[model samples]
Target chain A: MTGSLIILQPGHSVVTDLGRTKGPAYGLPVNGALDQFSAKAANILAGNADNDPLLELTALDFRMRATTDLLIAVTGAPLDLTVGGRESPQWEPVSVRAGEVVAVRGIRTGLRAYIAVHGSFTVPSLLGSCAPDTVVGFGLKLVEGFRLETRTTTAPITQPHFGLPLFRLGITKPAFTTNPVIDVTDGPDVAEFGDTAGLLFTTQYAVSPRSNHIGLRLGGALPERQLTSEVLSRGVPVGAIEVPSRDELLVLHRGRGVTAGYPVLAVVTSRSLDLLAQARPGHTVTFRRTTVAEATATHRTACLELERLRQTINTVFGLLGIGAGQRWYELSPASGA
Target chain B: MAATTTTTSQTTLDIYESGDAALRVVARSGDAETNWATVHSLAGWLAATGVEGIHGAVPTYDSVLVEFDPYLTSARQVRAFVLLGMRQLDFVGTTLREPRRFEVPVVYGGDYGPDLDRVAEHQGLDVEDVIARHTAKTYVIRCLGAPAGSPMMDGPDFPVPVPRLKDPRLSVPAGAVSVAGRQAVIAPAVAPGGWCVIGQTPLTVLDAAREPLVPYVPGDELRFYRIPAEDFGNFAGQFLEARP
Candidate 1:
């Protein structure tokens, strides 16, 4: 675990953590993992802290060779994961020996996949995060021949399967359905949108090809503006559904700039933002209006479920004599809604 | 006594719910200039108060976006807390501090300023006249958003509003001073911008090591002074600091 993980083929890979929690005041964008649930689950399964830095893979195949015995977890999108040409299960922790090649290929569903190692990636952190922000222009981009170093010297678990009552915790996958109906609350400018707000829920929007970490551009129906006056540039939150003057309707994501000028029609709920992170180009999506009270309630329920799973994992790992994950839990308890 | 008396009929506040975890508060009742100043004061007051679960307050022209943890505290609680805080904040007294002043050195025209000649031609003024007019007034920083430490300032009494470029540049050089709609900004980082660039500053505006990151905070006053092209290279990597 102390050795390096060499990237043989880097396919749009980058290191990401919980990102900067304190930079919005300085106009710095919070560029964390798009799918927070999946990223945290991967880290939990890999015996790392929930907010530890991990590799985020998108679309294409990724190949990395481990230089030390390590326990890693692959979560998020469904992908063909293998170690030394042998098939391995994703969303579950698997042990890999030193000098073994792991391939994560053939992304079948969703847009991104996460690879979380037991010790976590050792990279430069800015504003207390390793997540890359393209606008401010900082962070490490995974390239071919790039080597990622790890800190811990010993692996938490040496084998994938154990003799003492094997346990598996089923997690709700952050995957997109054929046409997912996402819930949203009123945006700051929702009143200004007038009757045009109805068009957002009524029409099925196809995720445009230009979508990236910054945001998703939906190419179905553009909500017409009722207030024609130009709005002053204001702070923008993640999952804000903005209606620009022209072109496709935009849904700002975590990688969005701290502020924007377009008037926002609605904002995707916290739980719905995780689902939207799995959205890919050409996927059809529909929006459903909800209240802030209801949205917060739903997110609270989701957080309680994750907390239950973490407790269960702690007990299971303790029974298996794995102390690394429990140490992380004791050090820093998970913080979320 | 004056603080309590001056609070009546001075400002109106509207709190808008942004998603589940954030709230946007817009202040009105005054002119555009005072409204933005009020926003800065409100942002500072809210951040200073230890209202549980409130993470950060981002201030813009006339509004403040307060981001909070939904699980720890609900929007209802945050809204109530903000309302209470507003009443307690003395807008007419000590809450608002004196504006910090800074003089930014810039090299105008030629290669340093690609769009200088075009801006001069559109305004029907000579290059020297454009520089003189730009440096004439003491601008106030309204907000900071996007491209790191770029301060969105308002001032420099131009005859008419200068329009943005039809097509924005792919990458505007760092410290490039640009203007649009009578507002001016010095680009802190090389970023894509639509505002016409008329000059460049050699001083570095963003440093991760520096506390506050940027030299000046919102509501600070800035005055631009002309520096020869030769002096621009001399000040490379030098941070733009506030006048002591």
Candidate 2:
């Protein structure tokens, strides 16, 4: 189907989907929508599948012209939005007429926002994900003149979507409004770091401006060095907060290097990791030690909630006459070995 | 403690819970051969097993990290599965595949390898001697990381280890071969790194559009040949490849 959208002012936006989760052996991380929770919500509102491609907008201030009438939704890290010069709200589906402009700016709360269009974007993928990763070369970064194709045909959105109750029922709101009290557990090096061990929770660390998709470089009280030399290099996880010799604490994110050399202090819990992704520079962070049981429960609750939303979306789409979109979720065409 | 099983002379197999999300299996420790074997054997078994939650393992220099869907399987349960695999692991019978070696053409010792003189001087060898020693051994792809498909390599530990540049270059162009602390790396994409530059290969180390994506994969072997700088443009598309 030929549906197109033209970029007016591309402000650090890239086509992204549920990231590639299976290629660490090939030197790739599970890269996807950094804020996956929001990514899913955006898709639901836009009447797309959970893994459909979305525009991952960093720090907002983006403008795009809807060349075709398309259903769209903006979710994650509240950004001031406007459609055709009119104030638009987030967390709800928005219908834009052909030639109408959908603009986003003034990202006050979070670092990233997901803008999903009805019927996923048909961007070229590397190894099955359309997510643009700086590390692993795939997909194109959105620029002013670039055009994006839609997987479905452009049928004008007529109904004003009332999906607020669905959102309320699904997806628990994060506790911390301004500063996230992200939950973390002891890392692999928990036992080895000797006496002054609880520095990760005890000391206050702020997100440094030097942070990027690769990692969040933090400027905080330097963890006392128990060892003088580097350890054996090994694969690091997404939320591993690796501590080098001195003050800087690096919390590896979705785009973490496949392997790491530094000793790890803590690993952020799966649910709270989304919050960490939104912790922009200068944002204060506090760590709360959580048990594996509690962490699993939290994740399970989130998954169940997302699942509920997905069911709700299924019903909504069925009523709207858009059958469940094709399976773009599978990472590669090759069947799972 | 993760149940330790199958003790070897050099290393032991152990597992660790990496965060709450996944489990890591250290098939073997320290030695590269044991580790490579453990990783391959375990990966092969797991892929064959096709367990619900076992996503698969990523190998490093001395370990294979098994990332899983925590919701479907716990660390304790995965450990039990791994232990079962360990029992079946015929370390003695597992044949190491004859490595596929690629001969990469490189232009050594000039602006491309700015630190070549420094590397030679520090190792107490002449420029030609340094080049000879570097080109002599076939390096194994130890790890694939940094912008994907970039190979962190290991070889016969250099008689004299090449030291890293005190200040790393802001951007080492793609296909630059460099070494530090007895290991080598071919920059798959232009990015800043600490490894001392030795030479540049005109070959596309990582072209996303390329069929195989990367010219080489981990566990593969590669050797470099000195080529004239002017000959770089002469070699277009994929470079001459040699497989063992």
Candidate 3:
């Protein structure tokens, strides 16, 4: 069956304008979705894959016109949502009447938000990812008058009966505190710094406003460098904290510079990357080393738990005899026995 | 005073865990050539031996980073495998494949290359002489997958290695041929950069729409062909078509 389409008009949102470009002087920081896991979860709620295209709004204005009833979920950073001028909760699936305009306003808490609609968000796909790689201008950035096509599912619109807070399921909740403790493992070049440097990492460091997805310019007592000579350029992965000089500690992220001459002191594990992504300027961050075994174990467990959650959602939908698009707000379980 | 000589022997391979997902193998000595050769040899051997659970292996100038599925393989096991591979590396030759030669056309001087004269002055040579020297030398590609497939080529063999610009521009136009230290690169797309621009290439090193998105691979030899600004559009179109 041909799915319905919704035309989304982008408003004054920061997600529309931030990304990487070659020019100016320093490399552009890829700042888009801060909580990728939460964004993925929001997509899954809309019956789409984890990697599907979603609107990433960063404390800005975003508007959408419902061509038809849409099964949409808004996750990540609490933002005020108004449909026909009424307050709506940020996390749960909401039903909108045809042609009603839905608007998202400045984030009251948190730094980023994700809005996912069922079916493909008709935007050009580059590099097999609908997600924008701001480091390279490859995805659709929401701009005024830009129309995004989203297929409206015919499945009965279902609102979440479960009132559980989204954060309980490993998603970040809107909180006032900015200081976050991020876990890390020693980088390949960590040995370049003496034993004192390792000790210094455990101490708290302030996150500078200058931080972005490319890398974080850490504010703290600069770690000492034993080897001051230039390091041969090498491939860098996300969460790599490299110290180029004695004063600056550059914590590399997903959209980091392709190569760097600095010596990397530590790398944040995959499980904790989301936390680092949400870190705000002036946030206090501290690192604690974990054994290779511990880090691997944590990642494995997290993956398994996520898979289990998906299965649970499928079972719940099946038991209700109501397919994904069915909107039933009733909390009663499917009848049996 | 008596003349004395000291010789130090160390392990050819040193293994360290790069977080939980990967481990790094670094050569003890700080020699660039030796380190690169060793890393390439090690990577080649690992591919040939069919190490289980290894996602992919990338060799840099001084180290080889091996990423493995954390679920399937432990970092300890990967490190052990690398150590074992180092022991058997003698059976495998340390030589890399011969580099493929390609002529890259460049529009030097004027706006395309604002720093050409500065680079020339730094080398105590005329701008034309600088172009001649740059084009004369064959450069080896160390890595090719930077922003928009920037080819990191080895050298101009200058007496003094040039430093990056103290104040980098926010937007450096694509196809910009730049040099920093002993390395030269062709910017595949417009991005912020600090490298001194010596010229601009007509070739698009990376094009997403094209198959084999990145044109140059590691072990490719590059020579620059100086072209006038008027021919840039033609050369760019031809370069795009040449890629399959």
Candidate 4:
């Protein structure tokens, strides 16, 4: 049995407004997500594919109506949960009846949060992704008075308990005291930067207020260059840390333009991209060089762990006698229903 | 260092890792035609090879950026696959299909293009000549990702390339045609710009509400035609009203 769930469409309000331009007049890309990792984890917990679409809400400006009672798990940045204005706990599965309004408000720990529905949300695909390319205006931006229709499935609200997998992966948050270290490789026109400037990237830098999805503006000693002439515009990608001028480092984001003329200092690894995305204004970020072998190993390990988490959830459900064909399963431990 | 040799064919391909997740294939081609052709051929070969972990490959004028997930396929493996794939590419310069052409009507000089006189004086060409040289040439679209469908075109090899303003204006109106260095581009949406404004196009280059969203694609040709300011306003109004 499947049911349709309609999430309210967003109003005209933008979740993360565009940032101001800086010297060299470069525009900063506003890149943020409600719970970057949790969003990914929620899909796995719900037994959905790793890349399934999830609703990312920042500071609680989201509401959805349940057309079918479905299992859901909320992760990342704690948000105030309310069903018809009634308060609920964060980071847990709750039974939501049909026609009930699920409301979420922002929390102080993080600006963004992730809400994963058991099944995937129904939205038109843009550029081969359901993820909202906010800069390009390709995907749906949830606002007030907006309606979103979801595929309805009559699955019993079976909450699969999951834990944060960070510790198991030997991953720990970098101490705020230490400079935020990002790994990078050489880029096109890297030779244009002198040896002294190349060494300058090893030093500490601060994330400026002028950061966004398009790119992050790093505040640090201006790296000197051998050639001051302009470079022809070319393709740029997320994590392409480009130095358009002296004293600034522009770290590209997911929505970065396809081409650029700026000289890139380094490319951030995939593991640290989400961390960079969640960085707030004026936060300190550092850079460190990593060997290609080490970067590849880290990326492989991360993907494996994500796959393992998905398997664990499926195992838990199977043990409880909740097969995929069952319409609804009981949450409490019991004999045959 | 001893040079690596290709097994399938003698065509030499230099493989360098861009990062842990990406690799670059540098072909021995210095001229524009050879460079672009190599990029296009390599791009086609990679697509046919069905290399695992590759998300997509974007071919530029001289290079191709292969985006892949390091988790699925290692950089070393991808590099080897690309090298093997390159050997299969039959070197042929296929003429790229012509994209949709647009005759963009513009109102040059005056408020729309405040720097028209400056450009004309700098080149020692009269205003009419400046407009003629700009409007006469059929510009090829090299790329169009910045500011949502802003076409970066190769302008007529003008005697002198106009430099961008030292301090860019706060905002340049949409459809404002500008030149910087040896390139000309139209402002898709109203935003701050550094290019020297020479004219304004009445056609909407980027409209998110529209079906295609972007009006121009790479390889498209754009020709600018001069029109009165009043005519520009009338056409712009009609275009906006036509949209649902």
Clashes of each: 0, 3, 27, 30
Interface RMSD of 2: 2.2
| Winner by TM-score between candidate 4 and candidate 1 | 1
Ranking by DockQ: 2, 1, 4, 3
| RMSD from true fold, candidate 3 | 6.5
Model 3 — TM-score against the truth?
0.81
A-chain TM-score of every model: 0.90, 0.88, 0.78, 0.73
What is candidate 2's lDDT per residue for A170-242, written digit by digit as tens? 4444443567888987776766677666777777788999898878888777556477675666788788877
Tell me the tens digit of each residue's lDDT in model 1 across B137-220.
Answer: 898888888878579988466777888899988989888999887789998888889998999999998886665578788878
What DockQ does predicted model 2 obtain? 0.51
Q: Give me the runs in candidate 3 sitting further than 4 Å from their true place.
A: A2-33, A82-87, A151-176, A195-199, A245-247, A320-337, B1-11, B27-34, B37-55, B68-99, B233-236, B240-244
Selected candidate, larger DockQ, 2 vs 4: 2
What candidate 2 gets wrong by more than 4 Å, as runs, is: A153-176, A325-337, B1-11, B28-32, B47-50, B91-95, B155-157
Q: Score the docking of each candidate (DockQ).
A: 0.47, 0.51, 0.31, 0.33
- Model 1 regions more than 4 Å off: A1-3, A153-167, A324-337, B1-10, B50-52, B91-94
Q: In model 3, how large is the Cα lDDT of residue B117?
A: 94
Choose the strongest candidate by lDDT: 1
Highest TM-score among the candidates is held by which one?
Answer: 1
When sorted by lDDT, best at the front, the candidate numbers are 1, 2, 3, 4
lDDT of 3 by residue, B153-237 (tens): 7878676788789998998988889988988988877788999998888776666565335556566777888899998888755
In candidate 1, how many Å is residue A227 off? 2.5
Q: Is candidate 1 or candidate 4 better by lDDT?
A: 1
